[model samples]
Target chain A: MTTHLKRWWPLALLLALAAAPYSALPLPGLLDGPLGSPGSLQLIALCLLYGGLATGYDLLLGRTGLLSFGHALYFATGLYATDLAMLEFGLGFVPAALLGTACSVLLALVLGAVSLRVTGIGFSMVTLAFAQAGAILVQRNPGGYTGGEEGRSAPAEHLPDALIGIQNTANLYWIALAYLVLVLAVVHWTVSSPTGRVWAGIRENERRVEVLGLRPYGFKLVAFTVSGALAGAGGVVYLLLTGGATPQAAGSDATLALLVMVVLGGSGTRWGPLLGGVLYTWAAHRLGDLANSGSVAELPSVLRVPLSQPLFLLGTLFVAVVHLLPGGLAALPARLRPGRAARAAAPVTAVPEGAA
Target chain B: MNTVVLLTCTGLGLGALYFLIASGLSLIFGLMDVLNFAHGALLSIGAYAAWWAATDGGLGFWPAVPFGVLVGTAASVLLELALIRPLYARPRDQILATVGVGLALPALITGVWGSDARPFPQPAALSGTVDLLGAAVPVNRFVLIAAALAVLLLLRLFLARTRYGLIVRAGVEDRAMVTALGIDVRRAFTLVFAIGGAAASLGGALAGLYFGSVNPSQGTGLLVFAFVVVVMGGMGSVTGAAVASVGVGLVQQFANYYTAAGLGDLSVVVLLAVLLLVKPRGLTGRLA
Candidate 1:
């Protein structure tokens, strides 16, 4: 919590990580290898993205007390924007990301202005309507760029010379880690700021926050915009890293996946998404190995099922955790760290404060 | 005039179906305030139940309808006992519980029945087509529509004319106050669950007939559409859900007919969004 510790902690982590390469290389073990490669990176990115989303969602659901299910609209918009930028304009990943996310901020403003008028389930439904609308628009008219149902693939435009020289997986894993770290830093800054405090106030009770002379809706819009921007950024990373996106990236399934990740790992917790994503990804990938063969393709056709059914597991996890572990993964360290156990034991109100 | 009549008739016909399905959704939500995401799944259950019973289950369509209804209604009862009972108070928890139950049945069905979409044929009695307004509508659909109307009438009577209905209305308005008034809240929930189950089953059966196929994935699509209906109509208002259900069905059907195929779904989504965002309630002010 101190300035000195905060400054040195990241450095220590960096140094420790640097030393990892020098140390006797640890085997991939249970989660290490050919299987874990793309899967692990995607899960890690997913965690960071959800961390951003859950925080944004919390701004409404947890903070402002509004639950908007349609946040995916902004996400999909950013994705489309990125899609065009990278695939059509041939922009590098970073610039394409900036443009897409910037566009999302604007789109969020328009969406938030209208939808944020009502809170709770209404907000959630309205947002969903927007997401559905966006999906339909893409489907109906590819506009020669949206790629319709087939979806637009991400052009591999930004791989640095350094990455090209090294193994591709290592480069991607590092990119995932770096982006995640960057997102954490931004979230920490926001959470600890005065604006976030108003959000905290907004979450407890709108009338109370309004009584304090701050407009809850306005702050909520700001929070929503920030959240949308981050989600957009996540979509960009997804497109750029995975190659491209379709309406699938922005559908209820994908958004629900993010929600599941947040709830399972711990919504409002900085690292909870990471933890939750790990659980979900592992469950999803390994569930196919029900017979212990490690490959879904290897399994008998009779036993084979679409990966979507595992969504049930993730969904179950969301229900269990919300009612059971409302605090999410961030609550873990608080429970373990010597003096923080007591703090973690307090009511759910302060859970967000210790999240990051 | 024909287009208008056609659309309105179509709306009413579709509305009848939505009413069948949504009534259960509304009743369940009304009684317990739990937004059952799996209401559609229950419909799927009913559809498959009817399908398997009548066809593979060795019964015919007429018999299958009741069988499916039983399957759906029973599943609803079991779901209430298993999950809904415990999470009655909290909205999020209730959402989660209902969703989990919804997810489970569909997954199990998918596991049992492969991923390929299968067709469930309407029995010969209802399979014939009828000509009206120059349109040859299916006999099964007309029967389904008539059956749906009967259901609406029954639901109306049940809700407006019965002691259970009065108690349910009271339960929706203030669950605690109803308990304070000496009604067994738990019993009310049980009744609601049964009513909801029947509605879901009937709706699912109807959906099965109309679509001629019922897949496990049907629940999620129907679930989202129902949520759109609920919010569009107004949360906890049976009338609102009924109307909104009709509205959604008409829009979806007509849009598909009129607009570019893929674009139509988008338009429906966009229309609902604009309407909701502009009027956070709905066409009928259902935000609450």
Candidate 2:
């Protein structure tokens, strides 16, 4: 029983974290400040939403080795679909979410078919261009459905009473937690399956996979579709939490933020992105607050300028992480212990070769 | 016919600006196999530096141009040595690092210069419109064209006449061979990057004068256009960049003239899509 528990420790730890907000047990001071505040639950919910989104993103970037720059389109598709359904079509939460996810899946299908033709850097650029076009199209708001640049919102009447009332923190937290867990299960199943093996194979060597008589394109399409649908679902959760959606939600910045989250968390690992989402969101919030305040000005003048700019820190962190910790936060535990070199040399490494 | 001539000249002038910006991008990529996403940041830095020199240094517009180019070249050299050197072999990290620099540079610019756009006054000599074959065109447009021609001529002469230029050209075709021949490929790459930086800054200064303003966000749009031109022209070919810039300029100008109000930009997106699908190697690039 002890050996079995040791093997499943990570999952067990995650479960404990999922229950932390509702546990009602007083966490120590540092944890209490971040998790016990009235608004802190919202941050957790955000982490879960982004974590699910990043996990979905990894299905392409990590699992299939495709680097798409316009993935926020799928997330936006889901949100806008939900927003339109709830506000314009007068649908309930479940129906609206279904509509959003279905729309995301359909859009993914079309995008995957066209974009999977090109691979590597060309593919990334094409995705970016398409995403920009998609954003423009949304801003145009055909038939006045998208609300243009103003964006669209879910009507208060369509939301569940609990979700509508911001005071229902526990309810919102549970729903977000459920969404994240569901995503983790789905991603875990997908990556562990035969489909996932083909994806990793494609990432390693596309030509060899082709020689093996497997049409990599079809498998890639599946991964793309799955990722889009997953990100779409995340978008729906965002709508429920925020009550609105903007075209900027699918812009380049959104894609970049998602990419940063995935990379920070360790791209290929199921749990890595979830942790990345939590850590990134928390860090951004904390660092941004610190930079905006007078406290940072007290530091050395030269350090003050860079420290105050959160983006500079984030960018520097990105470079440092890619260089120093190629396997991301997921590999840190293994790095800390003895015999680290052998573990680092393992072939199942998530870091892209020669990327450091 | 007058309107057509005016539009044609406008297209050429815009294309020249693109050519200046993209030539450096192309040259650097061809030689280093590194895509400097921060290229646009250098352009913006030049624009702002020229604006600063004109307004703050009291150097007036004409004298500030050289200062702007110098500042841009210095920044590019700093970027290459401090940030880019370590990530040479790592393509993905290079992209991310450059993107980080790209994001951070604008923030710094905004913090220093404030977010508002500042006017970049044109010199009295090039401020007015002139009649060109029955069309009233801005003298600035003519100057831009002339500047582009001058730079292109210099580049041609440098590549053809100088031993250093020969080394650069050889380095572009095959890095290993040049290295084997005992050439300092690193120094050649640094020179190319500096030249590219100067060219972009020159483009930025001209563009600032052309538009009558420089802003923190100035580089974003131009950077996108430069990237498209670099890719569309093929990665490393200066000639390809020049030709593609003109093509993009023509397409953009015509689209703005003919397409629906919001759809002008969509035309470029569509063009990029079709180009990628039909000929992924771009117009002149060998397949990667």
Candidate 3:
């Protein structure tokens, strides 16, 4: 989700990604869409959006102490902004996307300024209230701008003139996959930087960071803005995926699901949230399909599960992760990495300096 | 205005439920400083248990409430031993672990119960209506309100008048100091955790009756509202939570009423905006 993403990455990831399309691929048409069909491409676009939202969540909750339960507000704001622009004005996707991202980032700034000040549970409460309010506003307003409960769709959907030339599904999928790779690389780099280290410092001890005369607020604002913009862009992609936005886009259960996804995947790790989201989204779809098709009497009756109740599952998963895998599934990869333990242990050596 | 009154009544009942669920959470947070996210899931467990007891076992709703509380208490005791105990030393682990358990365990429940919402019908004796201010207020609503108030008052007496309550209060202030005072602080912690689970179940039992249905997702819905109450009321203060729950309940009710669109959720958004701008610590709660 980094805008000015660097081109170069480690050789391993580059080689792996380069081989993605060609190497031992799943044969086309195994299910429905071809390898690069519009459906598949749209799925990739949504995955990327999930990745970006997950990253935004991690930046605040995982890295910092702020855990806002209402981030769907920003995502919804961006989506609604895009929808409204297209409906009201004859705006193209490009300008509409940019405008959407801009408005959402501004919204995040306003929210963060307030929500971030209240750490921990208070932060969660404030954000929930904010997002719920947004959803409620859209619901009651009948024929006014938001189209009431129904919501407005993007008619005359503009696939950029540039995309029109290519028009193949594979190209769009590749583009989305590339965006995910690029965003993670940028976030990885950010975490490895001195500023990232400072953020970690602030997370551990705030009074100490202030005592050291390093202004954590500036970095926090920067982080908030960057995370907000990336999330907004992700919202645009989500808008593209669904072809519209509604107050449903701003539900607490959905947002909580996403945040729990972050925790499941490993909060601070680069790849954790993506892993979590992919698993969660897949399970959700499958479960939803099963539950809708039959009554409790059908099948094992166990399979007839509704979508909303899955939240209990999500909550339980979160609790168990904290209980057992303290570091998350993300920690497993690092444990296997060469000299990671030594590198992690190196922190023990630095503790004296940290104290000094 | 009528809407406000209606919402206030409803919100207070819900807030009372919040008090039950969050009381345990606030107590644990005060003493251990571990944010118990799984508390919501615990409430759901009680709800399901009561629902099962009432439905499959053919027990009455009145009997099911205590049954649910007991079932919730057992779950909490096990949760503390298995999930929450290990994370006691590492606060971050505790937070993440509880959150993780919160997710995975709920999944297991949904997996088992088929993830559908099933109703826990109120006893017919409590189901009749009474006239209140030219409005049709169900006898059940009054029961719910009275139940919440009764719990709150009982909790107050427990904390203020009882010996264990004073120890728990002292423990919240400073666990190490409490240990120095030679009261078994860890035992006290476990007791508080059990109490929290009990309170959560009691709330869930009430919720099932009030809604005339218990969905697995009900706990998740109440989680945020409970959090809002706990945060606004501040940690370690049950009275603050009680008051805040009523306040938020009233606010949410009014939002449901006059604001239109069946409760101006946007009003909540605006309220949060103002709250963050003004008192980030919450109206009555202290900053963490």
Top candidate by TM-score: 2
Worst 10 residues of 1 chain A by lDDT: A347-356
Tens digits of per-residue lDDT, candidate 1, B64-114, equal 888888888888888778676765545565665665566566776776675
Candidate 2 lDDT by residue in tens digits, A27-58: 44224344644467777777777777888888
- CAPRI-style grade of the A/B interface in model 2: acceptable
Off by over 4 Å in 2: A1-6, A23-38, A140-144, A297-301, A342-349, A354-356, B1-6, B132-136, B180-184, B283-288
Cα-based lDDT for every prediction:
0.66, 0.80, 0.68
Better of 1 and 2 by DockQ: 2
Tens-digit lDDT track of model 3 for A80-178? 888788777768878888899999889888767766666555556667778877776676654588877787776545646434333543444455566
Worst 10 residues of 3 chain A by lDDT: A347-356
Count of clashes in candidate 3? 37
> Clash pairs of candidate 2?
none
By DockQ, the better pick of 2 and 3 is 2
List, for all models, the DockQ compared with the true complex: 0.47, 0.49, 0.47
Docking class of 1: acceptable
Who wins the lDDT comparison?
A: 2
Over B235-268, each residue of candidate 3 has an lDDT whose tens digit, in order, gives 7788877887777767776666665655534554
Off by more than 4 A, model 1: A1-29, A32-60, A157-166, A289-308, A329-345, A348-356, B1-12, B262-264, B277-288
Candidate 1 per-residue C-alpha lDDT over A8-95 given as tens digits, one digit per residue, 9 for 90 to 100:
8867865554333234433353344333344544444443444445544444444445556666777788888977887778887678
How big is the positional error of residue B2 in model 1, measured in Å on the Cα after superposition? 8.3
